[model samples]
Every structure is written in structure tokens, then in C-alpha cells.
Target: MQNKKLNIAFFGSSLVSAYWNGAATYYRGIVRALHNRGHQVTFYEPDAYQRQENRDIPDPEYAKVVVYPATQEAVYQMLEDAASADVVVKASGVGVFDELLEAEVLKLQSQNCLVIFWDVDAPATLDRVENDPADPFRAHVPQYDLILTYGGGDPVINAYAKLVAKKCVPIYNALDTATHYPVAPEERFQCDLAFLGNRLPDREARVEQFFLDVATKLPEQQFIIGGSGWGDKPMSANVNYIGHVYTKEHNAFNCTPKAVLNISRESMARYGFSPATRVFEAAGASACIITDYWEGIDFFFEPETEILVAKDGAEVAELLQGLTPERAKAIGEAAYKKVLAQHTYGHRADELEQLLLTTPRTATAAPSSADAFVS
Candidate 1:
């Protein structure tokens, strides 16, 4: 079975839309890469969260997508079809019926099938279980055949180990070369520095400290902030709020900026080794990237050369003050080459393929109707 082309069933937020789904890029990249490597993938997503109505792309040829209703019956119907799949993935944060899905996916586990709990936001999940002893998911963690995380290095792996997980691995985010690459600069996105991330509780304060604070220091420089939920937030006049940019415009968004910014969520920054998908996206677009300091960034790109690192808003201001277009281009080129060579989704897919083949399956017997979830 080492080289077997297994069938993979992915239960995620949405594969065809990114309206409010932050993990859409990560799903598209890895799934497309896996398809290219000859595996058959079937992505199942709930129709909740208005994702179907606001789809960014039609059904992709790479994976067969099944968009079911948000009702409990719909998940059960989907699980019946997923039972025989070689691998079944229940991702974190499906928006609706998440707890139901989390418990139900494990019922498909058997010697012939691998059931995985793929956490797109491992930092937040770990924080929750660590703080709450009665967290329901804590009991379910050790039962899965394998645990895969979006991007947490040692901190995440060890945390799972403490929960007695059979095996836990990190499948860090990566660039999709086909979808994210250099493009002609767009007038609307052109700015001194740009940041694109949805508004979230853990990230708001950091954004203030990094992007908004830096903008205050450089009153003359132009800045643009894109994403949902910042339409009314007060900010420096020099900073423009572009609001929710589509993925199709991502390359231009990154390329047009003199330098793009990346601010990790509070948990991710404290944990280290978690690089946001935007880091690779900007690097793939050959945009000079200025990111707030976090542990393990150097593991991805050489700082001060391939990528610029800043300790705080003051340091970010200083970096921007010194950055010239020519120097920015040189740094962008270096980053583009590095990511293409080592950090594309193809590379990540290869690692995942190996893990799937090597990780020993230690799941319990198939669940009975008596163990059915109560929703």
C-alpha cells in the first residue's frame, strides 16, 4: 500500500468558496497537489455560512465536491458515503454542526480506513483544551488514527502527545504555484504596505500593534488593509481599508504593494513555528514581505534578505522607511525562488503522502449504532 492511490474524503468548511472561510486556500492547495499525484479526492462541505451562495469558484475538476445541507441529517447522509473512503478528514471549524461532525467522523474508523482530525487552527484548539478540562473534544482526541495540524511545530506535536494521541503531525501551509504567482500591479492595491486577513478576536490587537501602529508613525506613507470587519474601525487617515479581497485578486494584491505584511494570530505567535498561508502567498507573488517577528520564521525564509522581520510597529516603520522598490524587488525575487523550490503545496503534499504511508494505524473497532452522536 506504499504507493497506493487512496480515496480521500475531506469534510471541510467549503472548497468552492472563500467568502468567510479562511482555510479555503489551504484546502485547495493540498487537494490539488494530491490530485496531481494521482489520488482521488472527494470534498464534502456544509451549505451553511452562505459559502455556497458566495462561491469564489465553481466546482474544481481536481476534487469532486459534495455540498450538503447544514442539518444533522445531512451529515449522517454524507458519512454513509464516506464510510468506505480510504481516509476521512474532519477539519476544525466547519461553522455549523462542528461538534456533531467531530464525533461522527471517528465512527468511520476501522483497520481499513484512516480517520484523521485535521485542525486548521491548532493553536486555538490546544488553548481551549488546555484551559478547559471538560472540553468535549479532549476525550475524542486520543481515539483518532492520526492527528494533523495546519501549522504548529513542536509545541503542537507535544501537546497532542500529552493527550495520548496515536500520532500527530504538522502539515504547514504552503503556496499553490498555479493559483498564486506574480501578476501585473493593480492600481487599487498599490500601496507602501498591504495586509489581507479577516478580522478575528485573537488577531485584532496584534494588527493594531503591527499595522495600525506602524501607519501612525509614518504619516506620509500610504497603507491599505483588506479583509472583512474593519469597515468602521478607526485608523490613521493614511491607511485605507479595501475590505474583503477575492482570492482571484490575491496575486495582484500582493504584487502591487511595495511590501506586504503578515501578522500571526496571538496564539500562533506565542507558540512559534506557525506561518500563515499569506506568508507563502506573498512570497510566491514575489512581493517584498514585512512580517512581525515570531519564532521559526527563519526556518521558512532567510530574514533581512529573503524576508524582512520586525520586532514591533517601530521596527516595521523603520523597515518601510529604508525599503526602496529596487531593494524590495531583489528581496521578492529571492523569496519567490525559495518558496518555489521548497515551500510549494507540491512539497507539502509529498510530506503528507509519506506520513500517510508510514504512520501506523491504531484506531478502535468500527463504532456501533449505540455509539451514535446525539445532536
Candidate 2:
């Protein structure tokens, strides 16, 4: 007999566009892809921030959005909603009440609901839990039926194994082909080089080292920076800052730049194979890319032909100076082709489907009759 289509509940922090975080984009892409594949997805998020502010993309049609409060009653309501789901996923870093949500999800697992703790910020989560003996998530890891990550390849695998996750899969960041692809350059975003990333402690230094420092050395080039929390930073006249470009504008931002800059976070850079969403975004837009050195990069794209890798500001300056526009465009096109062929939300959804099929369903807790449904 064919297996029944699973009812899936995706619990993340924010589904609103105003948040405009990488996690929001990842959720939007993966959940939308899953819905396209005929899986029933109910997305749960808190209405802490009005998502309409600076909204870029329209609300998703495929998934149902549930806004919950920050109390135990809300947790109970979430569990009730997830009771019929074959898989209940608690995504990491859901800003407001994620800890409570995770606890409730874990409790539901005791009643036979399959629970997944999807870690978007694997490195930071692992580091935080590892350092604090009192961390609640540390003890709960082993209870989760599956662990999924957005990035952090080997290091994440090792860390989860140590934590005793039954199955840990790194569902790395991928291009949302429908949203990100080649487009005509827009005048507002036109620049010789552009970098888009939010401010984070681990990533700030690398940004300074690779992006800001490089800008100072290349006074002749017009560089652009796009993301949140850089308004206070002193910038050179040659470098322009565009605050928080939305998902809809990513293509224009990428296509308008001669080359886009990518700097991996400290843990991701150390673990390798952990390409950020921006790498695929710029590549999908057929924009030339210059990235900082990271191990296992060759597995995704050819260093010189598909994408340029720089070790420091000096290497960045050299690539900016030496690479011809034609050659850069050719490289961008190559990377774009590679990304469309191998890395997209469609591919990720397929991988996730396979993983779900292969993983043994936990039989410890069975859903109540009213909480179970047939597709």
C-alpha cells in the first residue's frame, strides 16, 4: 500500500515580511516547495511584529498561518493544532516564545506525535547550549525524532551526534528559483560590488575584514552594502549602504552589481559546505560572485570559472582589478546554471521527502482519535 500524505505543521518564529530575516526566507521557500508537492503545511508564528511593515513578498497561499500568544495556554493551543500532524517541526530561533513552543512540542511527542527540531542557526544554537549546562534544549535534543539544519555541514553533524539526535540532516540553504533568477539591472542598486547580510556578532568581524576593509583599499570602485544594522558604521565615500533590501528586490540588487560579495559566518566557514542563501541568490540571478575562502567550496562551484574565492582584502582587490567584465559575467552564468541544476527549493523538498521516508516513525506516542486524520 502507498503511504498516506503526511499532515505537517511548521513552527517557526515569524512568517511576516517585516521581520525580513534569513530564517523567514528559508521558511517561505521550503514550506512553499513542500506545499507544491502536496504536503499539508500549517505555519505557526507569533504576531509580535506587524509583518506588513516593509513587506516585500505577498503572504503565502499554500500554507495556513497561525498566530499564537506567549503563554502556556498558547502552547496548549499549538499542540492541539499539531495533534493531527504527522510531523511537528519546531524551528530554532523563533524570537518570542520558541522555548515554550519547543517544550510543548516535546510534550506532544510523549503522546506519539513525531517532533523535529529544525535548527536554522546551528552553530550559534549548539554553542549556546554546549556552554550552558542549564540549557533546556540540551536535554531535549535526544528526545527529538529528527534534527534538521539550514547550514553547518560536518560540525553540525558531529554536534548533533554528540547530543544524541536520532537523525540529523543538514538541509542547507538553496535558491528559490521562482523568486531569484536573472533580471535586468536596476539603477538604484547599480554598483561595482555589493554585499547583503544582516549584522551578527560572529559575522560582523568578517564583514569588516572582507567587505569594509576591501572597500577602503579599492577607493576607485563603487561598492554597495545592503542589510540591517549598518547605519551607524562609518563608511567610505565610495561605499554606499542600502538598508534591508526585501526578497523581491534581491534579484535587482544582484543583477545590478558587477559582482556580489559573500562572507560566511565563523562557524559556517569552519565547517565548510555551508553556503549561505545569498550565494545561491546571486548565482541564480546570474551575477558574478566574489566569496571569502572556505573549505569544500569546490563541491558546489568551480572556484575560478563559476565563482571567485578570495582569501583576504588583497585577493579581493586583485580579482576586482584583474577580472574582465565579460569573464565575470560568464562566471556568473556558469554558477547560475549550476545552482538551477543542483541547488533549489525543489531539490531541498525532494531531499526532505526522502529523509522523511527513510526515517523510522517513532511508535512511542499515538495521537488521540480526534487528533488523527486520513488524507
Candidate 3:
């Protein structure tokens, strides 16, 4: 995989802004790791969703960023600019002109170059295509040279294979130690339990059950909730809502809480094997985490030792009942050691680099894989 540096062009949501874009941390970690490996990357993003107005970072030297107007002509121009790269990637949820970009990127496929579709949210995506027969993106599944997912493990792999995607790989999330490591606690973030995630429909119910409900059960315990759109939601008197924690503040947010909570969205919990970025961020901060029970968690973290798993509010309350600061610190330390050893974005980049080096380079296709998928 480290044989030679490849020129890569990436199209996705904002790389410099976490505003309304949950995949920003993921993009930065993976892209920066690839850069450290000596690969050159040019990132293309649309000027939409007010991301430019509320950027978490300035133009980074790791990747060349090209922000284009959200117009039809800009999509075509971006494709033309990326055509000469050794490998071109079109990531999911770019916010504008995504359909056009997804379909047209495949047209650049050739013998000397490879085109890939990287789905950052496979659980939601697979679920969407599964329910909708007339989905336009469903047809483009087989056109890309390979399908790469940020999470979703074997479930995602099998789903994509059924769609007859020539190949599918899961590049699970990991810590970027440089960005998300331990930080000194801040007074504003100190609490018994802290949870941070933007408000989305698929996740709100789960958050209510796992976080807000748990807060109600233990009225004596102080709880802090961060991220966008929760300011209006009713919460227990013991609960504190801090709106929209930025990427730079993630470490403090994780560290200040006695034990942070990680609740997956409904589709992700139903599909399993999906660990959100919060899990790693907490572990990196050496902050104990109580994550909702899901499949494949043990593969990443040892339950009851490295991490605490709770299936419902009752389970979370019980776990909190016995959790002392000393015990919490021990669990946090163990989780940190484990993730640093196996689950950082550096590790994910290595996995991706290997897959790219081994995948078939020619423009090719598998049969329409929607065979099992549609049924």
C-alpha cells in the first residue's frame, strides 16, 4: 500500500466546516492520514449550507480545497478538474447537486484511473434504497469501480455486493490523536453525563431514550447535551443544553464530563456495527463512555472493561449507579489505550490504502446487484 503516492481527488461535504456536516472530522482524519503517507489530495466542496460562514478550520495545507458555487455548471467543471487524478472519489451527502455529481463521476472511469463512491452514512443510505424502488442513486451503485463505507461493517458490505457493486469495503472511524486527544477540562462542560450530536430525526428518539430519559431517571445527576437543534427540546431540570460544540472543543467536551454518552441514530442502531465519531472522541480524551448496546461493539471496545454498554435507560441508570470517578477513569484509560492501538483514522487510512492498491484498476462492472437488494 505504501508502494507509491497516488494523486487523489475527493468530492464531499465541507472539509473545513463542521456546520451541518457530521462527516467533517472523518474527512479531515482520513485525508490528513493519506497526506502523511505522501499522497496528494484535492478536495472539492459546494458553497452551500452556510458551511463557509461557520467553518471550523481555515484552508488546511494537507489538501487543496476548491469551493465551487452550487450550480449545475460547477458540477461539470469539478468533474473535469478531477478527471486527471489517479483515483477520484465521490462521497455521499455533499448537500447540493449530489445526484448529478454521483452519476457523472462514473463517466470519468478509464483504464489509467479509478472512480469510487464512498458512502459516509451506509446505514441510512442502505435503508433508504431498500425502501425506495425508484431511487436514482440505486442505479449508480454498480457504475462505480468500488463502494467504500465509513462504517457499517459486513452488513454494508453484503448490501453493496447484492447491488452488484464490483467491490465494497468498510473504512471504520478512528481517532486523529493530533486533533482529538486529551484536553484540560472546562468549567462549562463539567457534568455527570455529556452527550453531543446534531439533532436529526433518526437520532432524536434514540437520544430521548438513552440520554434524556436517563437524565429523568436520575434527577440528582447533572447532564449536559451539546450540538445543534436541542435548545428547544424539553429536558429535566438536572439537564444542561449547550448548543453546537465545535470540532476544536470536542476534546474538552469529552474530558469535562464524568462519563460521556453515545447514542446512535435509529437506523444505525437497527443495523448495528455503527459507532459514531463521538465514541472515539471520548475514548481519545480518556473520558469514560456509556454507549447504547449495538452489534459489533465488542470488536472495537471490550464491554464492561474498556467501554460501558447500555441497552435502555434502565440499563444506563444501573451502570451510572455504580460508576465512581476512579472506576470511570480506569475504563476511560483502557478504552483510550485500545482505540489508540487499533481504531485511529491512521489505521483506517492504512486499510483504505491497501484496498485501493489491490482493487481492480480498470473501468469495470458487476451485474446489477439490486437483485437481492430490491427483494
- Arranged by TM-score with the best first, the candidates are 1, 3, 2
Considering TM-score, which of the candidate structures 2 and 3 is the better prediction for this target?
3
Clashing pairs in 2: 112-365
Two-way lDDT contest, 1 vs 2, winner = 1
Clashing pairs in 3: 162-369, 163-369, 164-369, 175-344
Instruction: Score each candidate by Cα lDDT.
Output: 0.91, 0.82, 0.88
What does candidate 1's lDDT look like per residue over 142-217, in tens digits? 9888999998899999999999988899999999998999999999998999999999999999999999998988
Q: Over 4 Å off in model 3, which ranges?
A: 363-375
Say which prediction, candidate 1 or candidate 3, comes out ahead on TM-score: 1
The parts of candidate 1 lying over 4 Å away from their true place are 363-375
Scanning candidate 1 in windows of ten residues, the lowest lDDT window is 366-375
Distance from true position, residue 49, model 3, in Å?
Answer: 0.9
- Would you give me the overall lDDT of model 3? 0.88
Give candidate 1's total backbone clashes.
0
Candidate 2 lDDT, tens digit per residue, 145-188? 89999877787899999998887999978888878889889999
Candidate 3 lDDT by residue in tens digits, 1-375 = 449689999999999999889999989999999999889999999999899999999999899999999988777778777877889899999989888888777766776578899999998888889899899999999878889988887888999998889899888888988899988899998889999999999999989998899899899999999988898999999999988889999999999888999999888887778898879988999999999999999999999999999989889899988999999999999999999999998889888898777777765542222321121
Candidate 1: give the clashing pairs.
none
Residue 128 lDDT (model 1) = 96
